[model samples]
Target chain A: MKSQDQVLLSVRNLVKNFELRANSGLRKTKRIVQAVSDVSFDVHVGQTLGLVGESGSGKTTVGRSVLQLIQPTSGEVIFEGQDLTKMSFEQLREVRRQMQIVFQDPFASLDPKMTVGSSIAEPLVVQGVQGNHHDKVAELLDLVGLASDHAKRFPHEFSGGQRQRVGIARALALDPKLIVLDEPVSALDVSIQAGVVNLFSDLQKRLGMSYIFIAHDLSVVRHIADQVAVMYLGKIVEIGDKDAVYRRPSHPYTKALLSAVPLPDPKVERSRSRIMLEGDVPSPVNPPTGCRFRTRCWKATDLCAAEEPQLEIRSSGQQSACHHPE
Target chain B: MSESVLQIRDLRVTFNTQLGELRAVRGVDVDVAPGEILGVVGESGSGKSVSFLAAMGLLPKSATISGSVKLDGVELIGASRKAVRSVRGKSLAMVFQDPLSALNPVHRVGDQIVEMIQSHQDMNTHDAEKKAVELLEIVGIPQPDERARQYPHEFSGGMRQRVVIAMAIANNPKVLIADEPTTALDVTVQAQILEVIQRIQQTFGTAVVLITHDLGVIARVADSVNVMYAGRNVESGSVQSIFDHPSHPYTRGLLSSLPHEGIERLQPIAGFPPNMLAPPPGCGFAPRCQLAIEACSAELPSLVPFGDLLSSCIRADDLRSGIRS
Candidate 1:
């Protein structure tokens, strides 16, 4: 078990709300989309906490809130014992060098006009680091398993995987203590995705940095994540060790999510019974009252609709927020 | 294989681009028996989608296509436009990945299905409307009659895909070519979509050719798999043979690279897929193959049978005998 002192980032009661204009009859009514609500987790040093969820689950919003990229409406993001939400612009800028993000689309993230070398060195220049930018760029390129010569090439010249490596190299240019990788390998092919995932682990081991690896792919998360957190409707439905979560999912939603992921082995895929959750995810603008997942949950009762379940230690050895824990 | 509902032999497709001839699909062969799901798995530019598109005559005029594509013993390639059109939606229906784009934005979902039925068959509007609702119900849409009147935007991503599946099966086509039908949806929705496809295949006895890159999806639904790399078939066999005993290095590399339960470090295949404009001589995957020898680059390896698999690797026998797994 990890000690409390080893926690690199601790988030509590994270909430993000977005305003939307809706037309009801002739009048345009303002609607608030509660994208993220009361989300909390810890990312320990030299470890990874995989934040997983389907679309509209607000997994991306939670990652952004942790870094103050998209400022949360209300939350306590304590990084190194400092609440990021309370930091001023100047103070946040100083802290920004130690935290970085790698986006999902490598192609869109990198500037097409700029050379890969300059793109990597932008962080160093922005931070006002006293060093040779060219050498630093080359070093970063080498660090990301790319040839140093690749520094001169534009983003268009690189393949999808190489562009992603360049993205990682840019993220590494600042030598950040924590990196929030938002679906970094989702765009690459399976063969290319493995290399990048391995590269991430390799970099983590060598640099001793922590990661908030946010992705929808459970199988990919299972391989890299030390701790796993399953998010649904902007809430952590389940949180525990990767082995415990994967082996015996406690929450009904988590069980259904895991069951939905098809195994590569045909025999296993054929034999394993799937917990097919009926109906689509409810609109986040007006999420189902009480338990957000109660609409599709087969075990839901009057109690589930009357009161929201809180994350509690379950019999399956994970913290799952469910009225009826399986 | 001769009793296959859809048989593709020596299928080849080339596009005349600005750079040069982009040979999207090299010589390839596939067979889909009635009620069987044939998964054509490959990465981007691997021609998994293109091979079937050529068969369906869906490709643009710039591409030069050849070889035989027999759907129910009728030749598709070089067939007359009217002949191909007549059989396209009637006997060979196709479902695409993006459903929103496939469906008209202004038209009601039911009207769209009705249009498809009217275009293919001589059904009356009233009967077609009733059939549309029935198809929606069959695809597991809630309140099919009411839902059919709704627009495409009204449905969720999963529901849109189900609507697309309903439209594809409206004519009750003998063969359905679904190109990444579930790729655009979420995992849970993908599960539902796969279930719908499976149910359609079972209920209608439709021979389905599913094109996708996700190995997991392929494993779950496919009876047989055809692995494509750099526009050619690298491996083809039953799902068990392909997953359990991958003979080709590309297939083996692909299987090993996937992040699964027991794998600590992924063994990613080195180098990217070959440039299709001017592919490497000999085996297309030779440059990336870890076990590639001098002879592997000498000539293109043909799909030769190795036990239950038809693998394109020259060292398939060695791979089968565990010389280097």
Candidate 2:
């Protein structure tokens, strides 16, 4: 368990809303899409907090808002004892050096024309780092399990996994205290995914850095995350340690999602009683007033439709946001 | 085994590209019996999708396919376009991963199914439209009649896939090829889609050729499974036999590499998949295979009998037992 004193990042009541215009019979109308709503969690130093959900569940939005890549509608992001939400642009630039990000697609993140070494060194140059940038680039490449000679090559010259290593190397160039990895391995093949995941673990150990790992794959999240948060339509449906959540998920949505994941073990896969939820996720523009997941939940009742539930610790020892939890 | 609704033998597909000939499929063989699900699983460029696409005559003109694809003794490899078209809708159908691409955005969902019906057999527009609504209802789509009038963009991903399934089973095809049908949907929605597929298989007694990279999907539905590696069928057996006793080293490596809740650290296959343009003369998986011996790279191993399964590895016999190198 992590000590309470070393809280690296604390996100409180984070909300993100996107406004869009719609054309209805030649009349234009503006609509509000609530991507994330009132989300809160804490990340301990030298640890990982995994945020997992399917597409449109706003897991990526939460990650982006925490990094202030996009301004949140209302929230408090307390990183390293400083409120990032309240910081001005001038103050934020100084704090940005310690907070970095690694994207899922390596091809799009890196510039095609620039050499991999320059891509990693650009951050150091922007921060006005004094030491030799080339040496730092080589050191970073080696740290990410890439050869030092790979610095001269372009992003296109490297494979998907190698390019992701370069992305990780770039994120670590400023000696960041925390890095937000958004679906870093979801785009990778199963064989290559493990190597990148192992490199992430190795880098964390060597640097003693905190990570906010965002991904849709629960199995991959289970491997790296010490604490896990399950998001559904911008809210944390469940939050607990890896063992408690994965072993005994209380909410219907969590149980359904976990059961839906097919285990490679044929014996277990064949015998398991799968929870087949009906219909697709509702539109975020006009989300269900109460529980966002209640539309498809089998345990839906009037209370679920009338009153929203709070994410509280239940008898199962995990915080699940559902009134009728199993 | 029951009568095989579809059979493939010595299936090889090659594409002439700027980078020379890329052998997409290398001597693949598959058999799908009536009312049975055969899951073909592999990573990207493993030839799982290309083999089935070639069988369906969906490949481009530049690609050359030399294989024996028989649907109830009807040869499809050398068949003319007219001949293949006749059998495609009535007896052979396919469901793709992204229904958004497969479905025509301009046409209503019901009209598309009606078009399929009118093209295949003699049916008026009214009767065809009614049958289309029935098909939608069968796939578990809510408000079948109302939904059929909407375009592809109106439906959610899971619903669009159901519409695709509806279009596939419109004429009760004998063999349904689903290539990653549930990959684009959510996990909970994927379970629903899988259930719909199973129900269709049982009700119509149609053979299903399910191709995907996820082993979990295969384990849930496939009665028989084929493990492909570097454009070849590395292992083939019943799902039970393959899961309980995987003989091929490649199969073992893939299973071990898969992330499971109980696993602590994943055992990643060291090397990448072999390049199809200039594949190794011997076993393609030998470079990444952990149990590979000296003889493995000397000559390409054939699919030989190994216990109840067939594995293309020289050490298949040794691996079938409790032995480990």
Candidate 3:
């Protein structure tokens, strides 16, 4: 692939299964939970692809599987012309230098005993980047809009927003090409969430880093994502450009997810008719026979229960897995 | 006009800390009519939570509260320990943000809720357990009988919050205070929780004080909105008035900065919230306000009535004239 046209990371037919124990004490009756089944997507250079789903929809599992943090049962993760799944431990460790992850909880992710500066410089030390780590630490802090003086402070001393900045600085320490932000700002206050999000956008612009931003909030995804993927029970129900997917959602699950987001304006919230999906999300271990969302989908039919629909492009690069597409 | 179910006047709450006395709430005035959901919107340390904690007499011994908190014309603030305890769960109850931490880990969910009802009212254990199941059903928890027997860890995050709500409303308090109730749940589940709260508020006709940082959650449940900053009320009005024509610069900035549905890009407000320990001398939001002036730094502004709204900014007159920069 040409340099500009090269796909930074491509996942094909990724399948991740967990051997969860059944309710009974029978070890013979082992059950498997298909956390991610046949999920495929590509992350281009300097682009962001958002993975959105409600709780228990396996969005986080997909993100972790891409990083090879969890070994996938079957699939290919082609990153920079190498299949990460087929790589050995040492090869995967080398690949990890080019990819980093910013976890959801800033407090939990950072070591409580370490200072913020030491935490950010830890990756450089591990990679044996020979230099004055203090200078690089200050530079990383400045990049994420933190003061140089904040280097000495521990994570507990800083506010929630500042700690997230520290997390971002740590993510950038390795000079990675791709950063998987798994709900980076979900644990923050709204005002603080905006600051961190803006910092992410600016850093992406400055460093040209690709991001796989995973979040359940559609509004936050809209501001950051170039491409959007809606997942339902370990499957990509819809994937398209930000505007096309949000403005004209093809799948019923995508539409319901969009309609469920509450608008800031009271008048608009009162006037808008919401597609409130009834019933809870089914278990992933034994999901519906065909379409996972067919149980609660309004447009589901007998055909939906019998035949699994493949994700296909309908118009203008927008793909959706639905028997009845809007 | 309907009688106010709860009236709070000049509420001042301060916590005695090692550093000094930290004034968390300063001269807050709030009133809630029957069946109205009053939203208190602000970032952390804005005194939105502290104000209600003082009203409910839920603060610790270190907290020094001076103000009148009246629920159904009965004073709560500065009441004796026994008197406050007597009215706490019966007349006014609060549901905290994290239900997992709020509920007892060792006790069954039903027992904890039953304890809440029995402590305030003269009910037997059997009757209280019956009432607890009724509350679980009221909050829309399926299989209430079986779910009630489970521990806090057995239920999901959303279900745990429902159990917390069940405990709060077990005594049928006249006023309910939900402090960031849906902050811990997912968006879809947050909507469901908010809808359940709204439905319960309507059914019980309880005055609710919904405290949260999310403007979207506020919009869905609030009949009135209060914009707080640095331990002070910057703006207060009917929800429609606040959304349509916000008189304060801080309120306008907050409303505009929110990422609404169908909007692609968000306009983030510059600067951070003022430090409550050492807030600015005059208007708390002057440092972040785009339309701030030298006069705004000279004297603190009091709540003044605008067109169908109340704002503390001196430039409220100019706010509607489109002079905000």
Candidate 4:
């Protein structure tokens, strides 16, 4: 709902291609996997923009690219009016202090040998912050609803939820303006996931930071996001206000994706109709021609195959990339 | 319950670990009637999977399993190795969460199914191969003959799951225990896999014991649900009653915490699951439960009959009467 001037981060025409070696007989050919393509979005200050898609949708790639954790193949990742793609390693390193990311598995993200306190303080030491590191670590631990004493324990000492809290506290160590949360709560139990999600909301409100919350669970995304972008095979198919997208999903894939999520209510789950997509997601190496979702999309036609659909504003006020959006 | 295909009574499973005797499953009872889908729903370490694994005799030597696990009126615990093996694939089959791990990567998909079929039944390889193809077809694998020759890695995650299901049902087992079968899959693919399982259940009248952490999955497919807490069945009932009137606080907390249509914010359960090695003397959920009283921590509340269900909460009446917000 914020104006364009309030944008914390703006991504334009972003693309990431990974080169993979394919062996045939004796010779090896370089096959390009189009992980992310022409993805554009904006994250407003203090708001959460959810990126949702199944595996291989390149949602994770988009998140990593925004932080310049993995440099984008091509496009503009403008943060506070500065293009990150054009920045050198040293320049990007300076900018990295403002942006951070939280991975799905907290256990894997944290070093097993290191105490959680050290893990939280590592970012501060790396960025060369002028402060009592111990106090800052304690403050951060408290901020994430964990006791300061927990910092003394190793990563394995904490529960899954506690470890995730540690992951969040570490991300917050640098006082980042934007955090790219790549499936932060996916690995936790459903009950524990809620607590983490609530903590994210509370932290955003308190710290006034923006978040690009990447997740495959649509319901979780709906619960947390202000803006929602639905991706398919590297390209964003639909993107808009979370309410607009959830209430009236314009893209066929979005509609199907929404329908497929089984509601917890037994009566509703039983009575509701589901859109069962026929086959697996097409490989990123040789993505379907024109529309990436055309193979699974029911409304696909000759036009969909022959010409790629540009993302246009639909009747629901959401932008959808499809020849015939539902 | 007399005609139940699978009956589990007072089932307890403990693992000998460095810390202590880690009690994974403790005094749980479950029954799955013929053609019924019994959903064993819980979080990680709730012992939903461990209990069923103990029943399947799949646990390692470190596990000490006791109590009764009756499949088709036959006791599996303390049974002879040959007897357990004879009934495992033929009468009681299990489909694991990861299809890639369940299947042998080196063997052809069809050959694996053939091997499974030929293991218990005295059938020729040629006939078993034909039967394997038929099973693949039944699981909705298109171009079955051509696909059968492909390796496990060649198949997609969804397709690999279908092949796993095909192999599990190859012998037309009376009971099928699918443990988190769709957890690793995408939502769309998960729907397809659930449909396949439903089809197989309907076509063969096979009793299903579906273990999952997702309540939504249970609601979508389960006839009856057994809600597991720290290694115990906290609540068990028809899906309608379990969803509509959750008697246990843990079950209620699990439901309310889910991201649904109208909820403003999630009401998360306050604390972590108890440490199994040194779990509290009373109710396992007492520490986190909002409605817990002095009595709740003092004594373990037994599963007593409520309206259309059994609840372990002593304050089940208070819960049903809307005492708490």
Candidate 5:
């Protein structure tokens, strides 16, 4: 991980395991789903870290754990040089003022009963910072490119993109240092996704905000992210700078995932042949012993299933966890 | 190209809702040729799904539909209930997005496929069961016999979709309309499902209509594409023409908005999709279009044919080189 003087968020050896019971007619069996395992990353001021993965990759779990939305099974999340795992409820709430999150589905994230103004104002009131609430709400609305009059309307009255802007406004209301965006624009249309992505960039520039953007769209991640981490089956398979990783990807999983993405251009697509991976993602509860991706890896050898590879820095500054790096 | 196996002409659908009449699909048309994949690209309210639902004669009573839907020169839109039912799963089949909901939960996976085969071919249980296992094997499902005995809840998302696809192809239909079949699955699973779809088209020579919002998915499988905006087809062309030189302002906006590897910044189209209840009298995309002129707001732009594409933009000639970042 890249060390920086101005570390906004640092995660070390993070892990999250969920417990579930499956009924088999007469009996129930307990199982543990290792959602996230030993995931670590660093976020600095005015930087964006894009976490890219498919379902069951634990990308969303990492985002949620960093935000303390879900308690990790074992890990250390340090925010502004203070460890969040050791903080008390009161202290954690105090620290939460500097952290906020924007969820994926704008339709469900916003409360239908509350006006947009009240939703944005809830954070301000919670922090007990005395101010003209109406003025603050209006300012926040304008900041996210929404009209000040939009504050009076409910979530259903607005479009998906507008609702997302309201969500951004609420996150910005707290003057947070870091924002965890979990598929923020995935719900929006292609044209609308661009607008929301641009707003994020502008906000990062104007407010000097650090972001942890989690999305499955590799192309969209290229535009917003400075650092990129590719996760597969509860572990980080590759992490490096955005340009380096996209240009000269070292990990086999990263290469396959990128090739699977279809470019909108027909000429480019016709010229390219996809490197398709075989089989579905193995269950997290019973993941493959050594390399999680060995089952689908074309270059897998006998040694791959015998020894788990550690994340090591390669020549291109990419920290890849693959015995057979491309 | 070969003759169109499924042709839709001047399709219009309006829903009688409480919030006024919502014109979901407005005179939309599409074509599917034998063994060719046609992609209908659009946003949530773009009527890509509605148009196909109308073509299949599957809309609810609240929706008023009028159009000419022909399957191999046979009419389907105004056909009798029995006629439509006989043709639906036999000559034409559809693959929905959520296979879990579409498939019966209590029935065995093989039994369901057997039912699909038996209903169309009038076969006995033993033969239909044999055909069901064969369909499963063709869809790349390993251990077809053992997996067929499992319930819907027992299979993974990808496997369930494979089963659904097996049922869709049971009768070897000429046309298969798949509406966002891969949207609910993971990317890896999406690739596997798409592979199955492509293989199905290759083996059965079935025409596929792949309706999805993902430009990536469309690019992967679609031979030709129809770009829909606000309940209308703004552009129709070969995949090459649509990507190489998009003539419609809406099509250009869509391509530009899509983030790619070389993209440094996104030039997102401003504003939102139109409200279908009271669609704009002029060009539906005029309010959000950067290339909108006075004429764009005064009247609807008729489809104008270019090299190999048809674009519904008044400024198509002026903006010929296409918009690319």
Candidate 6:
């Protein structure tokens, strides 16, 4: 069991809603997407917590909300005994030094006009780290497996994997305690993805930092995550230790997701029975009545639509939000 | 094996750019039988895309092509522009990576599909529109008639892909080339698209050449697999043989790098892919291969058969004998 002191960050009842104009008319009605809904989790120091879900599942919103990149509608994000939601704008800027985010698309995230070296050094300059920035830039480039001379090149010169390495080096420039890696390897090829995932694992071991690794690929997450959280329609349906969550998934959504991952072995793939969901995911704006997965869930019943199931501890530390958990 | 539907022999393609003459594809050979699903698996810049682009006669004038590409006994290489266009939309069709970009945003999806049908067959507008709705229904699009009127942006990524599949199969092409069809989609949605493509192939009895970097996807759908590296086919075999016993070092490394179901840790490949413009003197993968020998750097290995599998490696015999040295 991990000690409470080991917890580097804790989130409670986090909620974020975006208001948009319903239609183009004199009466501009407001509509909320409810991107995140009552999400809570903890990240222990030097450990990785993987938040996984499909598009519009609010995984990215939760990551941004934790860093206060965007304002949360409600709930507390306690980082080292400080509630980030309560902090002022100036105070939040100070807190931002300890938390950083590596975006999904390195090409879009990195400034095209700027050199790769300057991009990495920008974080150091912002944090007022007293040092020869050039030397520090070279050191960081070397850290992420890029040649020191690569610092002179632009983002376009590097391949997808190299650009992502540059992005990682920039995220590490501030020496943040927690880094939210949002689909860091999803854009890269399979061979390149393995390289990036290894680099992330190696960085965590060396820097003793925590990561909220957000990705849709469960196999990649299993390689690095200490705990895994499965999100569906803005809610975490299941979360537990990586082994427990993967070996014995309680929620039907989790089971469906696991079964959908095609094995590399042809024999195994042919032998496995795929749990093919019947319908498409419902619109997030107006989700299902109760369980969001009930629309396509094979095990769903009348009770599943009557009331939403809250995430509750099923065992010692494992949690699942399901009416009929396997 | 009776008569290959699409046969490519020693196909080479080079693009004249400001930098230099970039040889995108080099001496690549591929064959697809009727009703076969041939999987072309490779990393980015491995020429998997370029090879098919050349076969389809879709490359621009800037690209210089060589060798032979025959589709159903008709030569695609050195064919006149009109000759290539004659066989393109009707006899062969390609499903590109991004359905949104491939589709015209200004027109409704149903209209675009109807245009394809009318261009290929002698059908009136009314009959074409009805056929378009039926094609959407065949692809499992919910509320096909309603979706037919919607524009490309109105449909979800998965639904847009379904529309793309519908367009590819509208003319009932003999061969369909899907280039990374599921790269932009989520896994579940990707599975749905794959199922739709498989259904279309089954219903139409068309051969499929699926190009993707994801080995898992290839394993799920491919009857035969061809592993490409640095613009060359390094390994080719039945799906079961490639997965169970990969003779080529690059193929083995790729399989090991993938995070499997029960494996606790993933073993990533060490180095990046070689530059295509200035490929290595010998095996393109020699620098990163763990089993590379001095001979591997002296000359390029030829693709040779190894117990029902073909691998381009000097040490295929040693690999079969479980000998590294």
TM-score of chain B of 2: 0.97
Error of 2 at A248 (Å): 1.8
lDDT against the true structure, per candidate, is 0.92, 0.90, 0.88, 0.93, 0.91, 0.89
Compose the digit string of candidate 6's lDDT tens values, residues A224-278: 8999999998999999998888888889998898888877888877788888876
Residue runs of model 1 more than 4 Å from their true location after superposition: A1-5, B323-325
Per residue, candidate 3 scores C-alpha lDDT tens digits across A211-314 of 99999888889888989999999999999898899988889988888888888889888889888776567788789988889998889999999999999897
For each candidate, report its DockQ versus the true two-chain complex: 0.88, 0.75, 0.48, 0.86, 0.76, 0.62
Over A1-326, each residue of candidate 1 has an lDDT whose tens digit, in order, gives 65423998999999999999988999989999999999888888899999999999999999888889899999899999999999999999999999999999998999999999999999999999996989988888889999999988899988999999999999998899899999999999999999999999999999999999999999999999999999998889999989999999999999999999988899999999999989899999999999999999999999999999999997767899998988
Residue-level lDDT of model 4, residues B1-325, one tens digit each, is 5588899999999999998999999899988999999999999999999999999999999999999999989999999989999999889999999999999999999999999999999999999999999999999999999999999999999999999999999999999999999999999999999999999999999999999999999999999999999999999999999999999999999998899777777878998999999888889999998888989989767799998999999999998898345
What's the lDDT for candidate 1?
A: 0.92
Chain B only, TM-score of each candidate: 0.97, 0.97, 0.95, 0.98, 0.97, 0.96
Clashes of each: 1, 0, 0, 0, 0, 0
Instruction: Give the DockQ-based CAPRI class for model 1.
Output: high
lDDT by residue for model 2 (A1-326), tens: 54534899999999999999889998999999999999999999889999988899999999989889999999899998898999999899999999999999998999999999999999998989898899899999999988999999999988888899999999999999999999999788888898889888888888999999999888889999999999888889999888889899988998998988888888888788888877878898889978899998999999988999999897767799998988
Candidate 4: lDDT of B134?
A: 98
lDDT of 1 by residue, B1-325 (tens): 5498898999999999999999999898988898899999999889999999999999999999999999889999999999999988889999999999989989999999999999998999999999999999999999999999999999998999899889888888999999999888889889999999999999889889999999999999999999999989999999998998899989988988998888789989899998899999999999998788999999878898888889999988887778444
Index of the highest-DockQ prediction: 1
How well does each candidate superpose onto the true structure, as a TM-score? 0.98, 0.97, 0.92, 0.98, 0.97, 0.95
Q: Give per-residue CA lDDT, model 3, range B88-167, as digits (tens).
A: 88879899999999999999999999899878889999988888999999999989999889999988888899999999
lDDT of 2 by residue, B69-152 (tens): 999999999998999999897899999999999999999999999998888989999999999999999999989999999999
Top candidate by lDDT = 4
To one decimal, what is the Cα RMSD in angstroms of model 3 from the true structure?
A: 2.9
Docking class of 6: medium
